[model samples]
Target chain A: MKPFGRVVICGVGLIGGSFALALKARGLVREVVGIGRTTASLERARELGVIDRFATDWATALDGAELVLLAMPVGQMLGVMQAMAPHLGPDTLVTDAGSTKRDVIEAIYSNLKSHLEQVVPAHPIAGAEKSGPDAARADLYAGRKVVITPLSENRPEAVARVREAWAATGASLHDMSPQEHDRVFAAVSHLPHLLAFALVHEIAGRANAEQLFGFAAGGFRDFTRIASSHPEMWRDISVANRHALLAELDTYITELAWIRALLSQGDGDSLLKLFSEARDAREAWLAGRFDA
Target chain B: MKPFGRVVICGVGLIGGSFALALKARGLVREVVGIGRTTASLERARELGVIDRFATDWATALDGAELVLLAMPVGQMLGVMQAMAPHLGPDTLVTDAGSTKRDVIEAIYSNLKSHLEQVVPAHPIAGAEKSGPDAARADLYAGRKVVITPLSENRPEAVARVREAWAATGASLHDMSPQEHDRVFAAVSHLPHLLAFALVHEIAGRANAEQLFGFAAGGFRDFTRIASSHPEMWRDISVANRHALLAELDTYITELAWIRALLSQGDGDSLLKLFSEARDAREAWLAGRFDA
Candidate 1:
C-alpha cells in the first residue's frame, strides 16, 4: 500500500506517540511529525524514533501534511482544530483519537467548516493507566477495536482513508453514529471510570483509610486499577460526554440503590440470584473474549 | 513445635481444604478430618489429600480431635455450631474462618456457651474466584493478612493457638475487636464486592449489553473480576456484615452523588481534582504493596 506522504500527530502523548510508532513499524507513513507543547516530550519522542521530526506549532507541522491526527484531551480538540484549520491542505485527512466523538465532530464542523468533508472522528478502544511518549508501543493498537464516527459532511473517501490508516495499525474498525458511540462508551467505559474514582475517593475519605487500605488485597487493587488513569484526560471525557455519562450514572446509582435495599431488607435469596446472574454474565463475557 | 494431635475441619471447601493442606505441608497437624454435607466433595477432599479422612457427620469428625476449624458460609455457622456443640471435646480449641466476626462470635456464645473460652473468630484475607477442594493450595495463605477477632470469653491460650495455626500458613496476623474487624472489612472488602456485583448487574441490564461488553477491555475485566466470585459466599458475607456494609454504601453513594453533581454542573476542575486525589491515593497504595 502507498504510504501517507506526511502525517502530523498533534498531541504526541501516549496515543499519538503509539500511533506514530505503529505506522513507522508498519511502513504505512512516509514521514511522521509530532506536535506538542512539551519540548522535552517531543525531544524524547524523536529520540525514541516515534516521530521523524517534531514541531511546537501545529501550523508548521500542518504544512504539506497529507494526514493529521488530533490525539490531545477532548477539551482541547476545538482549539487545536480552529488553529490548524487555515493551514490544512485541501486534501489533508484529519482524524482524532478522542474518547468522545459527538463533541469532536461538532468541533470539526464548526471550526473547519470549509474542510468539513476532510474530518473523521475516531476513538481507538485501547490504553493503559500510564501516559506519555515513553509509554508508547508499536503494538498498542494491535488486535484492538477502533470506532470511527464519521460526520455527515465527511466525504466517503475521507472516511475510507481514515479507516485504512487505522487498519494499518492492526486494529479492527467499526462505524457508529456519534450519538451511538457516546452512549455505548458512556455505559461501558466512562461510567466505570467514574465509579472507580468514586470508590477510591470514598475509601480515602474514611477515618481509618490507611488501616483499611493496609488490609485490602488483590480484589481491591484490580477493582480500582482504572482510578489511577490520567485525571485530566478523564475529566475532559466526563465533561464532553456529560449528558450520556449522567444517564449512565443515574442507571448505575439506581442499580446500587436496589442492591442497598436488598442488603437492608435481608433479602439474601434475591441478592444471591442477582449476584449469580452478574457472575454468569461476566464469566460469559470473559469466555467470549478468550475464545475470540 | 508439637502439632495438634487431630484436627477436624467442617465444610471442607476452599478455606477448609486450604487450611488442611497448609497444616499438612507444615507438619502442624497430625490428622485432618473433613466434615461436610456433600459426600462427593468430602470424597474429593480425601482424594486430593486435603484431608486424612472424611466423615458425613461433625460428631464423627470431631471425635478425639484436639482442634476444630469451622470454615463454612457465614449463614451456616450458627446451625453448624449448635449441631457440633455436644460432640466437641472440652480441650478442643475452636476457631472459625468466617468473613464476619460479630455474628459468628454470637453464634459461638449461644451454641457453645460452656466452651466459650475455646472459641476464636478469625478471617483469612485470601481467596480465589474459585472454590471447592480442587482449589486448595498449601501456599494459599502465604504473605496474606489474617485478622483474628477474639471474643471476650475466648481464652488467651485459645487465641494464641489460633494465631499459631494461621502463622503456620505464613499469613501475618492482626488482632482487632470484632466491631473493628467488621468496619475495616466492610470498607475494603465487602463494599468492593458489592460494588463489583452492582456494576456487572448494571452492565448486564443494558439493552445493548452484549455489544457494550464486546468493547469492554482490561479495565472492565479487572473491575468486575470479583463479580465472578461465588454468589452464595458473597451473599452470606453481605448479609452478615449488613450494618457495616450499609454505612459504607451510604458513604459511597454520597461520594457518587457528588461526582454526579459535578458532571451535571460541568465542573471539570473539581472532577479533575477529585480524580487526581483518587489516582494519587491508589498509586500510593499500589506502590506501598509492591514496595513492601
Candidate 2:
C-alpha cells in the first residue's frame, strides 16, 4: 500500500491511538497528528509516540492532511464532523472507527455533505474493557475483523483507500451496507452489551447483592465481564443505534419469555433440546473461527 | 479430619470423581466404590483411579460404607436415595453435591426418611462447563466455596462430618438454609446460564447466524461462553430451581423493559448513569473477590 503523507486521528484513545501506532508500525503514514477534547490526553498520546504532535483545532489538524480518522464515540461524531467539514481537504480520505455505521453515515451526510464521497464509515471489531491512550497497542487490530460500510455517494477510490488503511493494521476487512451493519451489530454486539450491563446493575441494586456476588463464580464473571467496559463509550453506542438496538432487545426479551415459559411448564426435555442446540451452534462457531 | 474406611460415590462423573480424588489426595478415605447405571462408566472411573472398584447394586456399593456422596443431577437424587436407603449403614455420613438445595432436601426427606439424621446436604460451589470422569481434578474444590445446608433433623456430628469431608477437599465452607441457597444460586449462577443459553439459541436460530457469528468478538464470546455448558446438567438445574429462576427472569425482564424505555426515549444521561453504576459495582465486586 502507498503510504499517506499525513494522517490525523480525532480521538486518540485505544482505537485511535492503536490505529496511529499500527500505521506507524507499517510505515504507512509519513506523520500522524492527534486531536481530542482534552489537551492532557492529546499530550499523553503524543508523549507515548501514538502521534507526532497534537493539534487543538480542526483547521490546523486537517491542513494538508491526506487522511483522517474520526475515532470518537458515536455521540461526538456529528459535532466533530461539523467542526472539520469546512477545513477538510478536497482530496482527504475520511473514515471513522465508530461502533455503529448507519448513525455515523447519517452524521456524515448531514454535516460533511460535500465530502460524502470521502467519508467512509467503518467499525473495527476490536474493543476492550479498558480505554485511553495507555491501553493502546500496535497489534490491537491484528487478526481482528474490520467492517466498512461505504455510502451510496462514496467514490470507489475513496472506499478503497479507507479499506486499505484498515488493512495496514493486519485486520481482515469485510464490506456491507450501513443498514445491514447496524442490524447485525445490534443483534450480536449491542444487545449482548446491554444485557450484560443490565444483569450487573440488577444484582448490584439488590438488597442481598453482597450475598449474591459472594457466590458468583466463573460463569457470572465471564457472562458479565463486558459490564466493566467504559460506560460513556457504550452509552454512545447504545443510543446511536437505538432503533436497531431496540428491535434486537425486543427480540431477545421475547426469547427470554419463551425460556421462562419452558421453565414454568417444567419442560426439561425441551430445555435440554434448546440448550443442546445452542451449545452445538456456539461450538461450531468457535470451531469455524479457529479453522478460518 | 477422620479418614473413612470406605466411601461410595453414586454418579462417578466430574463432581463425584473429583470428590473421590480429593478425598484420596488427602488420604481421607481407604477406598471409594463407584456406582452408576453404566458399567462402562464405572469401569472407566475405576481405571482412572477415581474409585477402587465398581459396584452394580446400591446394596453392595453401600456395604460397610462409612460415607456416601450422591453427586448426580438433582433429578436423579430421589431415585438414588430410594435405592441406597435400604442399605445405608446406621452410622454412615450421607451428603450430596447437588447444585439445588430444596429439591435434594425434599429427596432426602421423601426417600431416606429413616436416614434423615445421617443424611446431610451440601453444595460445592465449584463447577466447570466440562463434565465426566476425565474432567475430574483433585484440586477442583481447592479454595472454592462450599455451601452446607444442613437438614433440620440431622445430628450436629453428621453436619460436621459433611462439612469436614468438603473441608478436606480444601474448600472454604459457608452455611446457609436450603431456601436461601436455592434463591442465591438462582440469581448468581442459574440465571446467567439460562440467559446465555437463550441468547445463543436466539441467534443460532436466525437465518443470518453465520454472518452474526462471523463478526462476534471477545465480548460476545465471554457473554455466551456458558451457553456451551452441559445441556442435560443445566436442564436439570434449571428445572430443579425453576421457581427462584422464574422470579429472577421476571425481575430481569422488567429491568430490560426499563432499559428499553430509556433507549426508546433517547435517555442517554440515564443510560450513562446506569452503565456507570453497573461498571462500578462490577469493579468493586471483582476487587472484593480478589481481596478475599
Best-matching candidate per DockQ: 2
Which residues of candidate 2, in runs, are more than 4 Å off?
A289-292, B289-292
Give the winner by lDDT: 2
lDDT of 2 by residue, A1-292 (tens): 7998899999999999999999999899999999999999999999999999989999999998999999998899999999999899889989999999888888888999998888888999998998999999999999999998888898999989989999999999988898899998998889999999999999999988888998999899999999999999999999999999999999999999999999999999999999999999999998885222
DockQ of each: 0.65, 0.70
> lDDT of model 2 at residue A46?
91
- Model 2 per-residue lDDT tens digits across residues B79-167: 88888888888988899999999999988888999988998899998878888898888999998999998888999988888888989
**Weakest ten-residue segment in model 2 chain B by summed lDDT:** B283-292
Local lDDT at B126 for model 2: 83
Please, what is the whole-model Cα lDDT of each candidate in the order they appear? 0.89, 0.92
Q: lDDT tens string, model 1, B186-208?
A: 98889989999998887888777
Over the true interface, candidate 2 deviates by an RMSD, in Å, of 1.7
Instruction: Give the per-residue Cα lDDT of candidate 2 at B58.
Output: 80
Worst 10 residues of 1 chain A by lDDT: A283-292
Taking the candidates one at a time, how many backbone clashes does each contain? Answer: 0, 0
Q: Estimate each model's TM-score.
A: 0.96, 0.97
